[model samples]
Target: MSVLADFERVDSDSGGAVLRFTGNLSLASLGDLPDRLDRVDGQVARIDLSQVARIDTVGAWVIHRFARDREAAVEGLQPASRHLFDQVVAAEHPIELPPKPESPFVHLLAEIGDAVFTAMHTLYGLLGFMGATVIAFWNVATHPRRFRFHATVHRFEVVGVSALGIIGLMSFLIGVVIAQQGAVQLRQFGAEVYTINLVGRITLRELGVLMTAIMVAGRSGSAFAAQIGTMKLTEEIDAMRTIGVSPMEALVVPRTIAVVTMLPLLGFYSALIGIIGGGLLCWVQLGIPPITFVQRIREVVPLDDLWVGLIKAPVFGAIIAIAGCFQGMQVEGDAEQVGRRTTTAVVQAIFLVIVLDAFFAVFFSQIGWI
Candidate 1:
C-alpha cells in the first residue's frame, strides 16, 4: 500500500481548532502540507500527531511551521518525534540579527586615528629611552668604576676598526667617480684642473661623513638591533634585571660610547681615503701630478669643511646607536621580531642621518660656511 496522510480540523468545546493528522506524515504522503497550511481557515490552537503512523524531517518542518504561523502548540507526539518537532520549530524561528553597515569614510577615519595613536605611543617610548640613556651616562660619568671598559673597547674595535676596510673602499670608489665626473663637466668649460677643488670640497664637507654614517647605520646599527633583540628573546635582558643590573648600563651604554668615540676617527679616515682616490684619479685622468692635486686641495679646500664633517660624525653615531638600541629594546620575545626590528633600526637610523645632514647643510649655509 502507498503511504498516506490526512488531517481534520476538529471544533472543541474549549473553543479552539485542533489539527488531527493521521497516517504517515512524510515525503511520500504529506509533502503538500505547506500549501494545505496556507488554506487553513481558523486559528489552530494545538496539533494532535498521535494518530500519525510515521514521519520524516520534512513532515516535522511542515507541522512546526504551521503551528508557529498559527500561534499553536503541538502535542501527542512520541518523545523522539517531539524532539524533532522542537528542533524544527527552533530552527524555523531563528533569532533576528542586527544590521552592520560598512561605510568607507568611517573606515578610513578609523585607520588614520589608529596610525596617529601608534605614532604617539612610539614617540613616548623613544623619549623614555632617551631619558634612561641620559641617566645611565650621568651615573657612569660620576662613578667611573661602574663603566664597562672591556665591553666598550670591544664594541669600539668591532664598530670602528673592523669596518675601516669596507668604508675606505666605498669612499675611494665614490671619490673616483666624483673626480671623473667633475673632470668631464669642467673639461667642457676648459677648467678641468678645478676638478681638484670640486672633489676636495664635496668629499670633506658632505659626502665623506654622510656616506660613512649611512654605511655604519646599515652595518653596525642593524647589528646592534639584532644582538639586543636576540638577548631579549632569550630572556638575557630579564636575567640581567633580576641580577640587579640595568640593561642600559651594561648593553646600551657601551655601544653608545663606542660609536660616539670612534665615528669621528672613522670619518677622518674615510675623508683621507676618499681624497687619496680623488688625487689618484686626477693624476691619471687629468694628467695632473699627485703633488699638484695635493697643492690644489690645500689651496681650495677650507679647514672649515673638514671641521663641519667631523662635527657631524659624533652626532650621527649617537643617533644611530640610540635608534638601534631603542628599536631592539622594543622587540617582543620572538625571532621574527628580531629580524623586523633590525631592519627597522637600519632604515630609521639612515633616514634620520640624512635628515640631520640636510639640517646641518642649511645651518652651515646660514653661518656663511658654504
Candidate 2:
C-alpha cells in the first residue's frame, strides 16, 4: 500500500522553518503534495526528508524544486534518496529552440535570400554536370564503338514515338482555340481571313515547339529521373562503375542524343498538325474553305518561323534531358527522394525551356527573322 505524502513546518535553532516530510514520497502517493508545497511560505532554511519513506524521482523533483525556490538546504536524506535527488538536479535543464525573426520584413528578406542562394547553387551544380556530360560525350565520340546505338533507339521510341499521340491531340486543341479566338477578334475588324495568319505564325514559331517541350519535360523527364533514381537507390549505378561501365555513356548519352534528335521532328509534326486543326476550324466556323486557308497560311507564314522552332527544339530537348538525368543522379537515401527528384526535374526542365525560348525570341527578332 502507498502512503500519502505529508509535511509539517517546525522552527529550528536558527529560528527558520524546517519542512519535515513523512510517509511515501512517490508518484502514486504524492498527488496533492506538489500543490500543497506550492502554497508554502515563510523563511524555510532547510527541508528535512529524514522521515520520507519509499522515495522516487517524482518525490525527489518536488522536494528539490521547493528547496531551490525557498533558498533552503536539503538534509536528512538516505543514501538512495540522495542519489535520486542528485540525478533530478542533473537532469534539470532549459530546452533550446530556434530563434524567431525580429520582424516580418526581416523574415521575408531571409526567405528571399535563401531562395536566391539555392538557385545559384543549383545553377552551379547543373553547369558542372553539363561539363561532365561533355567530357563523356567526347570519350564516346573518340571511340565510336563505345556508343550505345540500341539503347539510343530504345530511348527514341520511349521519348519520341510514344509521345506523338498526346502531343498531336494537345497541339490540335491549341490550334483550334487559337483559330476560334483569332476569328472572333478579327471578325470585329471585318478581317476574319487573317485568322489563318495568326494560327500559322504563332503555332509554327512559338506554341508548337514550346508546348512539345513542356509535355516532354513532364512525361519523359519525370521518367528519366524516376528510372535513374531507382537505379541509384538499388546500387545498380555503383555496380556499373565497378564493372568498368561508364554510366554517362551508357545511360545519359543515349537519352541526351535521343531527345535532341527527336525534338525537331516532333516540333515540325506538331506545327503541321496544329495548322491542319486551325484550317478545319476556319472551314467550319468562318466559312473559309480548307484550300483557301492552306493557301493563305502558305502565303503569310514564312519559312523563317519554321526554322526558328526547329533551332529551339534541340536546345530544349538537351535541357530537359540534362535536367532530368542530373536530378536523378542526385537522388539518394530512400524511395521518397526519387519522387521529389522527379518533380524537381520536370519543374526545372520546363522553367529552363521557357526561359531559353524567350532568349531565342529576342535573338531571332534582333537577327531580322521576325
Candidate 3:
C-alpha cells in the first residue's frame, strides 16, 4: 500500500519559503525529505509539523535538521511531533545540556584506585605473556621447523617493512634541526668546523636509535597490542591454550625476535640518512662546501661512536617490541579495550626507551665513550 504525504504552503516572503505539513509521518517516506529540502533553492526554509498525525522521532529528526540548517525556529509542531522535534533540536544544538558537575576529590581518588587495579590486571596478563615468550624462545630451538620460519617472517614484516619510512623521515629531520642548532653554537665559538663532530656524535649515539625506537613503539607496539588484543577478544588465545599450543611460543617470540633483529638495521639506516641531512644543513649553515663537511666527519667522529649507536639500536628495539607484545597479551574485554591497551603500549615503550637512553648516556659518559 502506498502511503501519502501531504503538505500545504504556509507563507512566502522575499527572503524564502515556509511549508506546513499535515500527515501520517513515517521513516519510509521521510528518506527522500532531506534531498528534497536541499533542492529548495530558497534562502530560508521553514517546516511546520503542528498538524502531523502519528509523527515519529525519526520523522521529526529529519525536519529538525532542515529547520536547524536554515536557522529557522520551529513553531506549531504537533504535540507528539513537538516532543520529537524538541529531541532533534536538542541533539542538533546541545547547548541546552546542563554543564557536567565536577566530582569531589574523594570520588576522583576512588576512580584512580579503580584505574590502578585495572592496570594491575593487565600487567598480570603481561607477566604471563613474558613467561610464555621465554618458553617460546626455547621452543624455537627445540621445535625448530614449527616456529622458526613464521617467526622470521613476522620479524621481516613488522620490524623491517612497517618501520622504514617513519624512522628515516624523523631521523633526517632531526639531523637537519640538530645541524641548524649546532651551527649556531659552533658559529658563536668560531668552531664551525666542529659542527660535524656534534652532528655525528649526537646522531650515532643517541638521536638515531632514540627516534627509531619511538617510531616502532608507535608502529610495532600498537600492532602487537592490536593483533594480540584482537586475538584475545576472539578467544584465539584461549583456543591456543586449549589445543596445547602456547600463545607466547606461537605469537610473542616471532614478534620480539623480529623487532630485536630489525631495529638495529633500521636505526643504522636512519642515522645515515640523518647524518647526510645534517651534513647538508651544516653545509648551508657553515657556508662550507659538502666536501669540507664530509672531510670533517671523517676526521672528527671516531668509529667508536658508530658502534655505540649500533648497540643502542637493538636495545631500543627490544624495548618497543617487548612493550607492544606485553601490552597486547594483556588485553581483556572488548575491541575498544584492545585499542586502549595498544595506545598504552606505545606510550610506555617510548617512556622506557628514553629512560634507557639516559642510563646509556651516563654509562657511556663514565666510559668516555662519546
Candidate 4:
C-alpha cells in the first residue's frame, strides 16, 4: 500500500478544512500528518478517513496523536476506530479523590464492618484496662478523693441528658410515621390494635437502642474525639504524664465511665420517647386514648426486651468510647489532625454500633429471644 496516497487537504463551510484519506496507511504519513494538520491552526480542523482502504497501527497512532495534541477533532471513525479511541481512555491511571473510605451505599456496609471490628477491639482493650484497674484498686482503696466521681457524673449528664430533647423529638416523629404505616396495613386486616404491639416490640427491643446508639455515636462520639484530639494536639496528655498522672486513670477512665454508665439511661429515654410518641399516634391516627396505649404496652413488653436493650448499651458505649479514644490518641500535633480524628471517631463509632446490633440480632434470634 502506498503511504500518503490519500493525504490531501480541502476547505469547506463545515467551518474548517479536513485532511481527507482514501488509500494506504503507514508511519511516515503518521509523522508528517501532525505538522500538516497544524497548518489549519486558526480554523476548525478535522481528519476524515471514511475512504481509507487500509489502516495500520502506525498510521492510526499518528492521526490520533495529531488530533489530541492539536485538539483537532477526528471524524468518520468506524466501530473499529471508535474502539481504539476507547482503549486509551480506559487505561488505568492515577487520579485524585476525596478520602471518604467509600461512597454512600458502600459506606453503610463499611460502617457495619467497622462496628464489628471496633467492638471486638474495644472488648479486648477493656479486658486489659480492667486488669490494670484491679491491680491499682487496693492502692486507692479508702482514699476520700478517689474516682473523680463528680466529673464522671457531669460527663454522663452532658452526653446523655443534654441530648434528650433532640432524640425525643426525632423519636416522636418516627413513632407517628410508624403508626401511619401500621394504619394502612391494619385497615386491611382489621387488626388496628396490633399496631400497638408492632411499635412496642420494634421500638423497645430494636429501634430504641439502635437509634440511640447511633445518635450517641454521631453526637457524643464526635465530641469525645474532638475534645481529646485537641488535648492530644496541645500536649495535654503529655502534660498529665509529665506531672506523674496516669492518662488512663485520669482521662480515658472518666470518659469511659461516663459513656458506659449513661448509654443504658439514654436507651431507656429513647424507648420512652418512641413509645409515648407512638401512644400519641394511637390517639391522633388510631383514635385510641393514651390510657389504652399505655395498657397495651404494659401487656406486651416483657422484662427481657428491656434487658436486651440494657445489655447492648454498655457494649455500644464501649465501642464509641474506644473508637473516639483510638482516633484521638492517634492524632499528631496538628490542627488539621483534630478535624480528621473527629471525623474518624464519628464514622468508626457509627460503624461499631451497627455491627454490635447485628450480633445481637443473630444471638437473640437463635435463642428465640427476638
Model 1 C-alpha lDDT per residue in residues 209-319, reported as the tens digit of each score: 999999999999999999999999999999999998889999999999998888888888888889999889998998999888888899999999999999999999999
**Cα lDDT tens digits for candidate 4, 283-366:** 988898988888888898787888899999898988787677667776796899989888978887888789889999899989
**Clashing residue pairs for model 4:** 115-351, 115-352
Best by TM-score: 2
Q: How well is each residue in 17-96 modelled by candidate 3, as lDDT tens digits?
A: 77776666677656566666677665555666666665676777766677767887667765666776677667664457
Deviation (Å) of 288 in candidate 3: 2.2
TM-score of each: 0.82, 0.83, 0.66, 0.63
Q: What is the Å distance of residue 29 in model 3 from its true position?
A: 55
Output the lDDT of residue 336, model 1: 94
Best by lDDT: 2
In terms of TM-score, how similar is model 4 to the real structure? Answer: 0.63
CA lDDT of each candidate? 0.90, 0.94, 0.78, 0.77
What is the lDDT, from 0 to 100, of the residue 264 in candidate 1?
87
Better of 1 and 2 by TM-score: 2
Worst 10 residues of 2 by lDDT: 98-107
